[model samples]
Structures are given as structure tokens and as C-alpha cells.
Target chain A: MKLQAAIDRVSLDRANEIAKGLDGIVDIIELGTSLVKDYGFETLKREFVGLNESTLLFDGKTIDEGEYEFEKGFEANADILTVMAGSSIDTLSKTYEVTEKLNKQMFIDLLEVEDDKIKQIANFKNAIYGLHHSKDNKNAFDAVSSVAAFHKQFPDISNIAVAGGIDVDQAKKLSEQGIANIVIVGGKISGADDPVAAAKQFMEVIK
Target chain B: MKLQAAIDRVSLDRANEIAKGLDGIVDIIELGTSLVKDYGFETLKREFVGLNESTLLFDGKTIDEGEYEFEKGFEANADILTVMAGSSIDTLSKTYEVTEKLNKQMFIDLLEVEDDKIKQIANFKNAIYGLHHSKDNKNAFDAVSSVAAFHKQFPDISNIAVAGGIDVDQAKKLSEQGIANIVIVGGKISGADDPVAAAKQFMEVIK
Candidate 1:
């Protein structure tokens, strides 16, 4: 299992600083939707200039106009971009095609998506299916149980990822479960007083 | 009925110019999701300084973190902010509460949302329920038919808006049908060679 650290709701300078500090520490570094929506692609594209390692994922959460958003996201130098599973299959297909064409990656954010919807959209084999919990919802998400249930439901979905308030212990549990390809940790890792140390802890546990 | 001209997938300077051009011509000027994602809220907040007459609607498409996105969108000087109807009831409620508290407006974009979902989310009495067709989809969307069907299904939803490939004739028909509170037209006006003339024609027909 790989550990993905998400950086969110912070200034660009702060985000860049954190990204640089966490470079090569985590498998993937996510630029959260807040940063993208707060700073725009132009600023982010320019700010996130060089990184020798760690794939950059821009949590675009594109719900519509998939082609335009995905193209722009890739042009902004994101190695991976995300789209909502709630989007139409056409939108999903378009984003997936764009990602494939660019030889990049796409993460399908399965937040608020029903079973029927997920089944319909599960055909994107190469796409990483992210079982996400909404940030607005106050409900507690048992990451391990959720992943187990999702795996049972969609056994064909090979690349599985789980996100939303995941901590080091949950990461370790998920890693132990050996089902999820990637475990995404947001506030637990990025929001810590020492993000690098926190990332190292998560990395060690996941490994 | 009101006419909303959506500005999308363009540079900020061009968007501002178009917004300035279509200031009082259209009832509402929509800064589409592309703009919000491309230029972002901070740039838009600073750039979209003042409007002469038309209300500004930002397509924030708040799927999660409803409060944060809604508050940020409203603070960006938008008269109306959009939230996805596909979002959870909690998210919808949170955004609606913010809208109510601010005495502003919320437009719920119902794209790819099932009838059951619509039934669940239809209780936001003051919110403008937008019946939107995905641009990514190649399927045909008869705006008038869609509006009529939605009205028939959810008679309780008083404030309704319809979008997707709307033209002057279709706008006239929608105005004649007298169900939708607003008719959203995108490329027909903004993508036209003579945007002002096109907008005037739409306004005249709707009137």
C-alpha cells in the first residue's frame, strides 16, 4: 500500500513549502480542491514548478465540462487529476480519455455516488477508484470496513484508494488489510505540526 | 423569466470584458465552473469588482465542504452560488442555510441527478432548482420538454431554471411555457460573433 498526503486550505506559499518538504517522502502529494479553487490553475501551475519525485495529484473534483477541466488540469502540470463519480459517464469517459491520452492518471472520486452509479462507472479499469467521504459530512468513516465493503461490492475495480480523515493507525490497518492500493491521509498528515515527520511516520507504517 | 449568460473556458481578461459587455443586457451573468477552476475565487473576487445591474452567479458547484465553499463564493461578491443537487442532503442543507443566513440565493444544479434524488433535494423552497444537461453528453436535450417534465414531477419546486443549448426561439418557448424562473443560455450568446445583438434578441423574445 502507498501513502498519499493531501495538502489543503492553505496559502500557495505554505502549500509549496509543504510539498517541497514532503517531496519523495510520500507516494503521492495531493493539491486539495481548496488550494486550486483559491489560487487558480495559473498560479498553481507556476508555483508547483519542479519536483524530482512524488506524483502530484490535483483534486479537481470535476463534476462537469470534463474535457476542458481535465485538459487545463494536465496543462497546469498535474500528474493526476480527479473527477466526481457523480458526473455523467460521458464526463467520466472524457476525463479518462484525456488522462490516458496525456499518459497521466485519473482518480475517480466516489463521493456521494450510489451503488448503481458506481457499477455503471466501474468500467474504467485503469482509473483509481477513490472511495471518498464527504468533507461536509460529520459521520465517522471506518476506513478499513468501508474498503472491505467496497472491495466486496466491486471486485473488478483493481486500483482502489480510500480517503477522508484517514490517520496513521487507519493507514496501518489499511496496509495490513492488503486490499487498497493506496491509502490517502489528509489532515492527519498534512495538518500536523510537523508534516514531514508525520509523513515519515505514515510512510513507515504503510511500508 | 430571467436570462443567464454563462461565461466559461476563457481567460480572465476576456471573461471580465464579456461580463462588462453583458452587464445590464442579461438578467444574470454566470461565471461558469471553468472560470472558477481556471482563474479561481481569489482572482475572480478581486477582478469582478462591481456590476452595474445584472446579478453575478458563480458556479462554485459546491459538492462537499458546502459551508466553506458557499461562504467563500458569497464573499467573492456573487449574488448567487451554485451547489450540486447530486450532493448529500446534509450538503444541500448546509449550503441552503448559508444562503438563507446571508439573504443571498442558491442555485442547485441537477445534472445526472435521478428522480429519487431530486425528490429528496426538492425541499429547499427558496433555492433555484436548475435542470441542467451535461455538456459532455452527446445526447439531445429538449430544454422545454425537460422543464415541463421537471415541473410536472416536482410541482412544489417553484423556482426552476433550465439550461443546455438554449437559443432565442427556445427562450421564447420557455417564456411562453411560463414554468421556469430563469432560462440559462451559454454559447448562443457568449459564443456568438455579436454577443450584444444576440443577447438583445434573447431579451426581446423573452419579453
Candidate 2:
């Protein structure tokens, strides 16, 4: 399993600072939706730089107008962009086509979607299927069990990611489970007093 | 019925020009999701200005982190902001609370959501329930019938809006239907050769 450190709910400068500190430490560094919506692609493109080792993912959470948003996001130098699985099939197809054509990546955020919806959208082989828990729900998300169940349900979906209130222990357990390709940790790492040290703890456990 | 002229997929300067021309003619001026994602809220707040008449609606389409997104969207001078009906009840509650406390408006976009979900979220009586057809779905949308059916299904949802390929004829029919409080027209108005003239056509028919 790989560790993805998610940076969110902070100023652009601060996010950049955190990103730089965790550059080569985490496998993927996510610029959360707050940054995308607050500052936007153009601003993010110009400002968010200097990452050489880790892949950068922008949580675009695009629901419609997939072609335009994906094009802009890719142009803004995003290695991977996200689209909501709840979007129409046409939308999913469009974003996937854009990602494939550009040779980048797409992360399908499965937040608020059912198994039926996931089955319909699961055909995107290259896209990472993310089992996300809503931030506002304040519910406990069992990363290990959730991954095992998701893997069992869809044996074909090999590139899996799980997020929502993930911690170091859960990360370690998920790595032991060996099903999820990426374990995304937000707030715990980004909101910590020392994001670099916090990310290092997660990285050590996941490894 | 009220007319909302949506500005989308155009340069910020062009969008501003069209917005200025349609200011007093339309009841609401929608800075579409395209504008929000492309230019972002900070730039939109700084650049999109000088509108004295129409209510400014930003299509935030916020699925999570409800309070933060809603607070930033409202701070960006949005008199009205949108939240997706597909969001969790917790998210719905947070956005609604913020909107109510701020004495502003919330437009709940019912894109790709089922009747069961609508029933759960329809309690935000002050929020506008927008019956939106996905832009990616090529199927023809009969706005008049959609509004009628939605009204029949959810009678408690009174403050209603409709969007998706609305023309002057549909606008006239929806006004006669007497259910939808607002009709959102995108390409027919903002994408027309003369946006002001197109808006006038819609206003004349609705009246």
C-alpha cells in the first residue's frame, strides 16, 4: 500500500509549504477540493510547483462538463484528476477519454454512490476506484474491513483507494490487508502541528 | 416565473459583459460551475462585479465540507449558492443552516438523484429545489412536464427551479405550469449572439 497525504483547508502558501516538506515522503500528494475551488486550476498551476518525486492529484470532484474541466486540470499540470462516480455515464466516459488521451490518470470518487452505480462505472480499468466516506457524516469508517469487502465485491477493481478519517493504525492495517493500492489520510496529516513528521509516521507504518 | 441567465464556458471578461447586459432583465444571474472551477471563487469575487440588480448565484455544487465551501461562496458575494441534493443529510443540514443563518438563499441541484433522496432533502423549505437534467445526457428534457411531475411527487417542495436546454417556448410553458419559481436558461441567453435580446425574449414570454 502507498500513502497519500491530503492537504486541505489552508492557505495556498501554507499548502505549498506542506507539499514541499512531504515531497518525496508520500507516494501521492492530494490538493484537496477546497484548494481547487478556492484558488482554481490556473492559480494552482502557477503556484503549486517543485514536486519531482510524488504524483500530484487534484480533487476536482467534477460532476459535469467533464471535457472542459479535465482539459483545464491537465493543462494546469495535474498528474491525476478526480470525477464523481455519481456523474452521468457520458460524463464518466468523457473524463476517462480525456485522461487516456493525455496519458494522465483519473480517480473516481465513490462518495454517496451505491454498488449498482459502482458496477456501472467500474469498467474504467485505469481509473482508481475510491471508497470515500463523507466528511460531514462524522461516522467511523473501518478502512480495513471496507477494503476487504470492496475487493471481494469487485475482484476486478484492483486499483483501490480509501479515505475519510484515516489514521496511522488504519493505514498499517490496510497495508497488511494488501488490497488497497492507496490509503488517503487527511486532517490527521495536514492539520497536524508538524505535517512532515505526521506524514512520516503514516509513511513508516504503511511501508 | 423568474428567469436566471447562466454565464458559462466563456472568458471571464465576456461573462462579465454578458452579465452586465442582462443585469436588470433577469431575476438571477448564475455564475455557472464552469466559471467557479475555471476562475475560482477568489478570482470571481475580485473580478465579477458591478451588478446592481440581479441576485448572484454561484454553482458551488458542494458535496462535503459544507460549512467551509458555503462560507467561502457566500463571502465571495454570492447572494445565492448551490448544494447538490446527492450530498449526505449531514452535508445538507450544514449548508442549509449556514444559508439560513446568513439570511441568504440555497439552490439544491437535483442532478442524478432519485425521489427517495429528494424526499429526505426536501425539508429545506427555504432552499430552491432545482430539477436539473444532466448536460451530458443527450435525452430531450421537457421542462414543463418535469416540473409538473416533480411537484406531484414532492408537493412539500414549493420553491422550485428547472434547468437544462430551456428555450423561450419551454419558459412560456413553465410559467403557465405555475410550479417552478425560476427557469434557468444557459446557451439560449448567455450563449446567444445577443444575450440581452435573448433574455428579453424569455422575460416577455414568462410575463
Candidate 3:
């Protein structure tokens, strides 16, 4: 399992600092949606650099106008961009097409969609299916069981990522489960007082 | 019916000029999702000005982290922000609550959602239920009939807004139908050779 540390709800300078501290130490560095919506692709393209060894994933969370967003995101040098699974099939297909053409990756966020919708969009072989838990919901997330259940439900989707207030222990469990390709840690890693040390801990556990 | 002239897929300078030209002319000036993603709310707050008379609607299309997005969107000086109907009820509720507390407006975009989902989310009385046609979908949108059908299915939803390649003819039809409170004209106006002139034509028809 790979570790993706998400930096969110902070100034670009702070996020960039955190990102630099964790660069290449983690497999992926996610400039979360807050950064994307707050700073945008233009600014991210110019600033927010220093990820030489890690993949840079902009949590664009694009739900419409897929081609435009994906093209713009890639132009900004994003290794991975995200699209909502709840978006229309046309939107999904367009984003997937754009990602494939550009040889980048798209993470399909299964945030608030039904099993039926997921089944319909399960054919995107190259896309990473993200089993995300909503941050707004006041609920506990069992990373291991959720991945197990998702695997049982959609066994064909091999490239899986999971997120939502994930802690280091959960990351270790998920790694042991060996089902998820990427375990995304947000506050537990990026929001820590010492983000680099926290990320190192997750990396060590995952490794 | 109100005329919402959406400015999209254009440079920020161009969008501001267009907004300045149509300040009080149209009921709403929408910095479309493209502008939000490309330039961002911070740049928009600083640069994209000239809406002294009309309501400024930022199509943030927020699907997660409802409170943070809503707060940032409102802080950027948007009179109205948007949330996807496909979002979880928790997200919808949190956004609506924030909007209510701030005394702003939220438009719940009904794009590619099932009727059951629509029925469940129809209770946000103050939210404008936007019947948005996916830009990626290569299908015909009969704006007037779509609004009528939506009204018929969910009579309780009063504040209706419709968008999807709407033209002057359809705007007129929607005005006559008396269901949609707002008719969102995208390319027909914003993409027109003379956007201000096109907006005047739409304003005339809607009036």
C-alpha cells in the first residue's frame, strides 16, 4: 500500500511547506479540494512545487465539464485528478478519456453514490476507485472492514484508494489487509504538529 | 422569470468586463464553474468585481467539505453559492445551515440524480433547485418541458432554476410556463459575439 498525505484548509505557503517536508517520503502528495478551490490551477501551476519523487494529486473533485477540468488540471502538471462517481456517465467517460489520452490518472470518488451507480461505472480499468467517507458525517470509519466490504461488492476494481480522517493505525491495518492500493491520510498526517514525522510513521507502517 | 447570464470558459479580465457590462442589466451574474476552477475564489474576490447591482452567484458546485467551501465561497463575496444535489444529505444540510446562518443563498444543482434523491432533498425551501443538464451529455434539452416535469414531480420545490444551453426562445417559453424562477443562459449569452446585447435580448424576453 502507498501513502497519500492530504494537505488541506491551509494557506498555500503552509501547504507547500508541508508538501515539501513530505516530498518523496510519501508516495503521493494531495493538494486537497480546499487548496484547489482556494488557490486554483493557475496558481498551483506557478507555485506549489517541490514534489520531485512523489506523485502530485490535485483533489479537483470535478463533477462536470470533465474535459475542460482534466485538461486544465494536467496542464497544471497534476499526476492525478479526481472526479465524483456521482457525476453522469457521460461526465465519467469524458474524464476517463481525457485522463487516458494524457496518460495521467483519475480517482473516481465514490462519495455518495449507490451500488448500482458504482457497478455501472466499474469498467474504467485504469481509474482508481476511491471509497471515500464524507467528512461532514459524524461517523466512525473502519478502514479494514470498509475495504473488505468494497472488495466483496466490486471485486473487479483492483486499483482502490480509501480516505476520511484516517489515522496511522488504520493505515497499518489497511496495509495488512492488502486490498487498497493507496491509503489516504488527511488530518492524522498532514494536520499533525510534525507532519513529516507523522508521514514517516505512516510510510514505515505501510512499508 | 429571472435571467442569469453565466460567464464561463473565459479569461478573468474578460469575465469582469462582461460582469461590468451586465451589472444591473441581468438578475444574476454567474461566475461559472470554469471561472471558479481557473481563477479561484480568492482571485475572484480580489479581481472579478463590478456587480454592484446584480446578485453574484459563484457556481462552486461544492460536493464535499460543505462548511469550509460554503464559508470560503461566502467570504469571497458571493451572494449565492451552489451545492450538488448528488451530495450526501449531511453535506446538503451543512451547506444549507451555513447559508441560512450567513443569510445567503444556496442553489442545489439537480444534475443526473434519481427522482428518489430529488424527493428526499426537496425540503430545502430556500434553496433554488437547479435542473442542470450535464454539459458532457450530448442530448437535447427541452428546458420548458423539463421544468414542467420537475415541477409536476416535486410540487413542493418552489424556487426552480434551469440551465442547459438555454436560448431566447426557451427562456420565453419558461417565462410563459411560470415554473422556473430563473433561466440560466450559458453559451447563448456568455459565448455570444455580443454578450451584453444577448443578455438584453434575454432580459426583454423574460420580462
Clashes of each: 0, 0, 0
Worst 10 residues of 2 chain B by lDDT: B42-51
Off by over 4 Å in 3: none
True contacts kept of each: 0.84, 0.79, 0.81
lDDT of 1 by residue, A60-88 (tens): 89998999999999999899999999998
Error of 2 at B13 (Å): 1.5
Error of 3 at B92 (Å): 0.7
What is candidate 1's fraction of native contacts?
0.84
Give Cα distance to truth, residue B202, candidate 3, Å: 0.9
Candidate 1, pairs of clashing residues: none
lDDT (tens digit, per residue) of candidate 2 on B49-157: 6589889999979998899999999999999999998888899999999999999999999999988899888888899999999888899999988888898999989
Give per-residue CA lDDT, model 3, range B102-160, as digits (tens).
99999999987999999999999899999999999889989988888988889899999
For model 3 chain A, where is the 10-residue window of minimal lDDT?
A: A42-51
Task: For model 1, give the RMSD to the true fold.
Answer: 1.0
Give the 10-residue window scoring lowest on summed lDDT in candidate 2 chain A. A41-50
Can you tell me which runs of candidate 1 are displaced by over 4 Å? none
Candidate no. 3 TM-score: 0.99
- DockQ, in order, for the candidates? 0.85, 0.81, 0.87
Question: Which pairs clash in the backbone of model 2?
Answer: none
- Give model 3's DockQ, 2 decimals: 0.87
